[model samples]
Each structure stands twice: as C-alpha cells, then as structure tokens.
Target chain A: MSSRYSWGADEHLVVQITEDMSLESNFKAMAMASDLASQQVDGLTDICPANASLLVRFDPDRIAPAEVERIVREAEGRLEGGGPQVLETRIFELPVWYNDPYTNETGARFRDRHQTPDKTDLEFAAQENNLPSVEAFIEAHSGAPWITSMVGFVAGLPFLFQMVPQERQLEVPKYVRPRTDTPKQTIGYGGCFTAIYSVRGAGGYQMFGLTPVPIFDPTQELPDFTDFMFFFRPGDIVKFRRIDEAEYNQIKEQVEAGEYRIRQRPVTFDLAEYEKDPDAYNARLLEVLYGN
Target chain B: MAIEVIEPGLATSIQDEGRPGYYNVGVPPSGALDLYSAAAANALVGNPSSAAVIESAYMGPKLRFTEPAVVAVTGADIPVLVNGQSAPSWTSLDLKAGDELSFEILAGGARIYIAVSGGIDVPLVLGSRSLYALGAFGGFQGRALQAGDVLPVGVGSGRPGLSVPEALRPQFAKEMDVRIVLGLYDYRLTDEGMSALVDRPWQLSPVADRIGFRYAGNPLQWKEREQPFGAGSDPSNITDAGYPVGSIQVPGGIEPIILHRDAVSGGGYAQVGTVISADMDVVAQSAPGTMAMFVPVTLDQALEARAEARARRAEMMAALS
Candidate 1:
C-alpha cells in the first residue's frame, strides 16, 4: 500500500500508511516503528506508531530532518515484503462492568451532545449496530479478543480493534460535541475502536462501561504497575470479561488493598494462521489463556 | 536553603529543559513553554540551562528566601520586586534571608520564568523536574506550588551582578505572525479553508494554558467527501493519531488549538499544521487577546529559523559567561 510522508513542523515527521484504519495498516505502522527503534538512529527522540500512521520526533540540531526521513524511507522499503506476521505479545483479561453507574451517570450528564439523547450509550450503540439488545452487543464485544492498535490520547490509554473480520466489527460514531469530563477508567467506544480512559478528563467517545482495574497508576501503588506506571502497550491483546456491579465493587476493594493482579499470559500471535480459520484460532488462543 | 511560597500566584510550577523520550507513551515533554527565556534566567543565575526553574503563569509568585542566594527573573514584561524594592529583570539579584520576591501586574506576555542560583531542588521524576500536573508525576509533589510550601534549593556559587544584554532579551508582542509548517492533514482542508487560516487574524482565547493555546476566528470549511471508514463523522475528525507538540487542530472547523509543552500525545481531531519549533517560544509569550496570523513556510525556511534561534541562544549564553 502507498504511504504519505509529511513534516509535522521541523521536529516531527509523520508517515500516514492509510486514510482508514485496518489491521494491515496498523501492523505495518507498528513494524516500521519497531524497526526504527532497533536501528537507534541518533537524534531520534520518539517513534510513535498509531492505528494507521507513525510519528517520529527528533532533535533537528543533532540530525537533519532529511536524514531522519531517509532512515524511515529505508525502513519502509525493508518492510515491503509485509514485515513480521507474528507478534510475541501478552493477552490481558480486563474485567469490565457494563452499564455501570459511574459511566451511566457521566453519559446522562452529556446526553445533550449524544445522537440518541433519550437512550443510554450502550442502548444507542446496540441500536446503531443492529444488535437485538444491549446484552447481545455486550456479548459480541466481550466474546472476541482485541488487539491494541495504539496507546495514547492520555497516559496509559489504549485504542483497541477487535480481531474479528471487518464485516462483524462494531461501529459507532462519537458524540456530536465532546464532553468536558469523563470518569477515569470509562470504557469508551468510537468508530471501530474501543478505548479505556486511563484518567478522568475530557472525552468524546461513547461510554459503554467502566473497568474496575486501573490501567494507569502514577504512584505505582498496585502490584501490576510496580515495573511501570502504564499497564497497556501497543501490540497487547485484550479480552474484556464482563462483570456485575458486585464483582466490580469486589475488584475495586482488592485494588484499593493493593492485592489485585491483572490476569495475563505470554503468547505468540500468528496472523497467517489466524487468517486461515479465525474462529478455530481464537478458540485455541482463549484456551491458552484460561486453561490450567 | 529553601524558598517559602508567600503567595502562589495564578499557577507556579517547577520546569526545566523537560523530559524527552516518553512521548510515545502519552507523556508530553512538560517544560518551560518559552525555553529561550527560561534558559536566559538560568544563565543569569549561573545555573545550567537544564536546571529546574519556577514557571509562573500570567501572575508571578510571591517567594521569600530562607537564606542568602542569587536569583534572576526573565520572560514577560513584568516588574520584579525584591523585599518591596524594584529590581531589574534579566539580571541577577542577591537576596538575604527573609527577603521577599514578588511582582507588579503583568505588563505583557502570559508566563514568567524565575531562576535561582541553585535550581529548584524538586526530586526529578522520569529524568526531569518539569511538572506534568495533569499526570501528577514530576516536579514538587507532582503539582503546582501552593502557599507555605517550602521548596528546597540546590547549592551553587553564582555571581550576583550578571546581566543579559537587552538585545538578547525577548520582546513580548500584542500581535504576532506565527510561522507554521502545514501538512500531516492539510489535504483534508479545502483551498479556501487553507487560505482563510493564513489570511485571518485569530485572537488568543483566555483558555490558553500549558496544555494548549486556543484561537478564536471565523470557522474554516472542509471539503465534502465520504467519511473514511473508522474515522468519525465530523469533517475535522480523522482516526486518532499522535499529536506533535505545537500542532494546530480545529475541531468542528472552529477555534484552532495549538498544543504546547504539556500536550496530549494523540487524539481524534485532525491537525492541519504545526507551528515551527523556533516560533513556539513566540507563541508562548503571547498573552490573551493577542492577535496572531498564521504564516506558512517551507521545511527549508523552518530549519533556517531553528538555526537562527539556536545561534541567538548561544550568543546569550556566551554573553552571560
């Protein structure tokens, strides 16, 4: 696929792989970012890979912008063969309380900006996707594992895309006008991606649920965040396990006591094998995650 | 030694050259918005350019020295007062124990930089003392200075009479022609919209802060087309992507916001252009109600401006030495 390269001022060089989001574009961008990081080009400050683009921030004084562009071009050329098909990553089980009170209250406050002001965010989302009920929508959402296409917008927030085929993907538009406040850990959906709000701040995405686990711990008070403050990273696989309010409160207590540990396992994801028989492959992956 | 905050002003926080290498993880390089002035303040106090300095917004903080120390104030056209006596800005001034440092009303500019001989001794978080207050991680207790807060000062042997040449000092302007390198999403805008962006003068909105500077002007129109899949329905919305520091994004084709030192790393709004690195300091100096016109330049021209800025900074440092 053709990519467009443009300058983001004197310091940042942006490479747009596609105008639309697709697993192909995401993988390509991620591969290029990984390759550039390994090359360790001098003056390179940040190499960020998004859903369909990569932004390279550099110190123009140490290395010319042209030189940085040349290195990126070379890396792109090297990946013409489609780069790596498999990623050695971790699958995390994230417990989410759908139709929770926190996000529901937040959604109510911002309903004036929503497309369906009379309906809750989950109900509107379900209606838009032609799902029979919100339960069916939740099932479709939580049933499939999703890959983290990017991590940003705020500290530790992850943008996730379902592993299912494009035809089966859940799609919903963002709010007509953005809200000035969003409760931290709100499970927000926009277009084809799902995002977990790592912090309480302004947001436009439709709130669907609230996760009890903290994806970001600035204090590093939690056991999972001992090594790093951010829990999500690009290329992580997330399986949202639906939970009730009781479980949510229970998990919150465990988290407050610093006893909660996220359920995760290391696994190698082979794209080619998954493409052959997605359902069978996903079943195997889920087995690997939950099996003793 | 420590400096006690008598009054915290509008918002005062510790800043330095900033923490780099963390942008990919959504952490912005939170630092002094105007690096040139911040560095000049440091030079006047015989501190390294990267040393942590106090950054005050709109209003200057009221500080009392706990011991004898050298200090300097730079950025903004504000009157500096030491123990209720007028002091020259952009020059080192000696303060004895119990000497109070304060400021008069701001004459121009939006931010001020205060540098002590020994840098503000806040414990560094992630390799820098700059405060990312939104994330609450870096600088003093991961927040802005509050009244009665005792800030520790590092030890330094700085001369008390050093001064920066007048020519090297920054001049805050009520109107500015901000240079930008357009692209990264300029294709999304129509030719008329592009022209309007450069032709119109936008007034800086009062919402300006460390996160971003918003400008109020006539809304630009977008070219009609089928919305790309997974991109939001709004004409200005693109799939969420990383936002470069100084990038300008106009949501709903209104009120373009230029992300600053404490910028959010990525978002759904389409950024049509980015302010050239050299002009970021100029943008930082602009106070509310400042009229700014966007001036687009080629990559080569942008680089030339960067070089000129670097040379000028070097000259300032040389003069201080």
Candidate 2:
C-alpha cells in the first residue's frame, strides 16, 4: 500500500468499522498507511490512539473541512497493506480476585429469569460447580497479548483491542444504572472488551475485577505518555490467563523489582458446559458478580 | 509586592492568556473571563500580553499592597480606594509599601482585573497561571484567592508609567455587546433553540463562580434530540466528558450551564455554543441578571473577528501612552 496518508496539515477523518469489534484482521489493514497519518490526525492528538480505523481531526488554518474528509477516506481505504505494520507486543498480566459472593436465584424478587438455583449451594463454587475457575482459565490461556489502538475517551485511557474470535463476545449494552460511586482501578467489561475505570466517579461496565496501577500522572515530564507503549494494535489477537493470588503477588513483586518478561499463549476450552466454554466464563463470572 | 486582603472580595484567582493546545487531552484553556481587561491591565504595567493578573468577581477585594508597585485595575470598577483615597480605574499608579487598596460591593459588572507590575508570580501549570479549580490543579493550589494569601509580585518596577484616556475611561468600563460564534452543535437545536440563543435575551444566573456562571431565563429546545434529561440524554455517555471553560452545556434543565475557568476538560452534555474567545472576558464581567444574547457565525468569520479584536486590544494597549 502507498504511504501517502501522513505528513499533511489538513484535517483528516478515518473510521474503523467493527461489525463485532474483535476482528483484528480488518484493523491491521489500515496500519500500512499509518506512517503518513499526521499526528494532527486522530491518534496523534494529545488524545489519539495507536491503531484504529479512523483518525479524525482538524487544523483550520492548514486545511478546510472538506479536505479533512478526503484524507481520512484515503487512509481508511489503505487498510489491506496493514498486516506488516504489527510490531512488538507488550503484555500485562492483570491480577484479579474472586472473593465476592455471587447470589443464586432464591426467595428474592426477579428469580424467574433463568434456571433453578443449583450453583449457589456449593462452596468454592469453582470446584463445586465443576467449573474452571477464573484462575484456571487464565493459567491455560496465559501470556495472551493486547494491542494498543488510538487513545480515545478520557485522559491517558488507551483502548487496547485484538481479542481472539473464540474469546470475543458482543459488548452487552452498558448497565442501565451506573454505580453511584466506584473506586479507581475498577476492572469491568462490556460485550467483548474489558477496561479499568482509572479513576473514581460513576460507571456502567460490568465490574469483575480490580487493579492497583495508577494510569494517570501529573508530575511526569510528558504527564501523558510513559514507559507503556500500547503495543497491541488492530489485527492483533489476545487471550486472558487466570493467575493465583500468589502468582499475582509474584508478578507485582517482579514489576516492583523491575523485571521484564514476555510470552504468547493461545486460549483453549472444553465446550461441554458454559462453565467449560472459554467465552462464557466472563458472562458466568459477571453473573456471579451481579448475582442472578 | 502582595495584595493583603482583609476580605477576599468575592471569588478571586490568578489568570493569564490561558493554557491552550491541550483540549484533546481533556483540558480547556482557562484564563480571565474578560481577556480584554486582563490584557489591558498587563499592558498598562509593561508586562507581556500573557502575564498573569488578579481576577475578582461581584466585588473586588480590599488589597493592601505590602510593597511599592505599579498597578492598574480594569474591567469591573467596584468602589475602590488607595490608602483611603479613591483610585482611578485603568490608570497605572505607584503605591507605597503600605498603600491600602480596597473595593466595596459592585454597583455594576461581574468581575474586575487587577494587574500589577511584573504580573502575579504564580508558577505556570500546562503553560499558564490561570487556576483550574475543578481538578484543583493550577493557580494557588487551584483554589480561589482568599484573605491572607501573600501572592508574590514581579520585579524591575523602578521604571516610570503611562496613562489612560480621561474621556473614554468611563465608557470603556461600561457594559457592551459581546460577540460570539455558535458552536458546531448549534444546529442540534430547534428553531426556537437557535432563536432563544440570540433572539431571546438570557440573564446571567445568580449562581456564578470560578468554575462557571450558570445562566437563567429562556428554555431552549432541541428539535433533533428527544430526551427527558438535559444535555446528557440517553443515546450518549449520559453524564460524562469534561466541561471546557466557556462551554454552555445544559442537562435536561431549561437553564444552560455556562462553564468558565477551572472547568473540567471533557463533558457529555450538548454544548449549544461557545462564548467566543474574545468575548469570554466580557462574559465574565456580566453581573447576575445582566441580559446576554448569543450570536452565531461561521468558523472563518469567528477567526476574523478574533483577529480584529486582538488588533483592537493592541491599539488600546498602546493607547495608554
């Protein structure tokens, strides 16, 4: 693909269409012409992301409204050559705990939604339900990678894409009622993607986990970009591996001690039941979190 | 030099040309509400056009200068005096070490700009000294100036000064029409929404502060959007996004929320229009209940108007000689 998209003063708007979001192949298509994409365009704004279909922005003096439209359309069309653009991948193993209780259908209201309450009677629900715990799933699918796209919505919050098709799920519409108050490092997800609410306020994503990393900084030189280079981009594929608390603490210790490590792992699943289906784990966990 | 406040007038803070170019990161450039008056005061004191100055609202504070310095008060003119003697607005004056500067409750206007020689010495955050009270990050700990705040003054004040137009001084202090550009989302409203923005005179809501001034009067309708809540109706993030300084975001409420300095960077509510950069200072000075009508224009026209206003300010800066 010709690299004629970047190095312009004109406003450009690029759109990344995702019929269902986890398709990395289409996203990788645009990376070929990214070199020409002006930082003035979408991902380069103090807020743009690294890999996305569209990059839209305007510099009124250098280009007009119409030019912005033309340039972005050109950039979007050059996606086929995007495959070679995938570079190094950076992986972060997030640590999560499943201590919260998942209520079962009982004598309470709204119990008629699904099956009889069989899962809630067991302790160590992971073992009792004869299901793979989040930790087991993560262990089997460990080292799955994540790619960075353009930075969009909120400050320093990068949108990391590239989920495996088998692992991908349609993002459920956000929760109708947002949590009145949530704390920072709150990990949650919608349909096929996951995110951590970096700071506290109101949020609607399904909350399944938490992290301790601070995503924003005010004292850094750039105060924006840092040691992290959202490595995953469009067309990248990733899996999530569950780690035990001990493993998590070890990684935390390693991170604190400045140890760097990386590896790639694919996901696997036994489809006998949702407890065994890899894709259904998130929904099950969410069911536990919200309680059916 | 420092302005010792027995009472911090109303709401006060340090502001300058404002920090620009960081909007995409969710940061709005915030500065004096009245850029015209702030620039005028800085120019009068021989400081750069971007130097920081005092922003006072409703009634200016009782500032007792702890050191001798040249100063000019512009924008709103509350009853002011130096060492018990009435001081002239817009003109530079040399105060002794113990000169007492004070202002009574305002008779008119919403704010006043006090620029001292060398400008207010607050450290620059994101390239401006203007306070962002929302995140509480910039300017005097990102809070309003209060009594006993000993703000540092600039140096090299031994040089002499200039004067203001004796005839035009009063007229310059008077309220006037402020130009604006309807925002990109302007068309998202009904004909009535568009009309109420300009045709109907809206009054400054009594609720005002460094964060922003909430406007009252005229319920604008969005013919295109259907919702029970104001700006953050359903189809969107609901109630998110940072509020840029000078944005008018209305929720489901009839009245509009006019954001000002110290505003959040992003917001989800619909913004009908932005108080054009040039008119922001004027907007800051509109007292509660003052009538305001927003006018719409294209981007190019807005740029041209801004350039003309900049040239006009340069002339006024030179006019004091």
Top candidate, metric TM-score = 1
* Candidate 1 collision pairs: none
Q: Candidates' TM-scores?
A: 0.98, 0.65
Could you tell me how far off, in angstroms, the CA of residue B18 lies in candidate 1 after the best superposition?
A: 0.9
**Residue B102 error for model 2, in Å?**
2.5
lDDT of residue B211 for candidate 2: 61
Candidate 2: tens digits of C-alpha lDDT, residues A1-292: 2222221112222232331232242234334234334434533332222232333344444555466556555555554433333333323344543222221111112223212232221122224224466444333223333444333234334344433344332233334445454455555443334544545655544444444334444443221224432222322233344555566567657645545243333222112232244356434433332342
The DockQ values of the predictions, listed in order, are 0.84, 0.10
The deviation in Å at residue A125 for candidate 1 is: 0.8
Per-residue lDDT of model 1, residues B131-219, tens digit only: 99888888889899999999999998789889999999988888899999999898989988898799989999999999999999999
In model 2, where do residues sit more than 4 Å from their true spots?
A1-211, A220-292, B1-6, B158-161, B166-183, B186-198, B210-212, B218-247, B259-261
- Model 1's alpha-carbon lDDT is 0.92
Best by DockQ: 1
Candidate 1, residues A1-292: lDDT per residue as tens digits? 6999999999999999998988878888888898899998889999999999999999999999999999999999988866567777888899999998889999899889999999999999999999999999999999999999999877788999999888999999888888999999999999999999998888988998999999999888799988889999888999999999999999999999999999989988888888887778888888888977
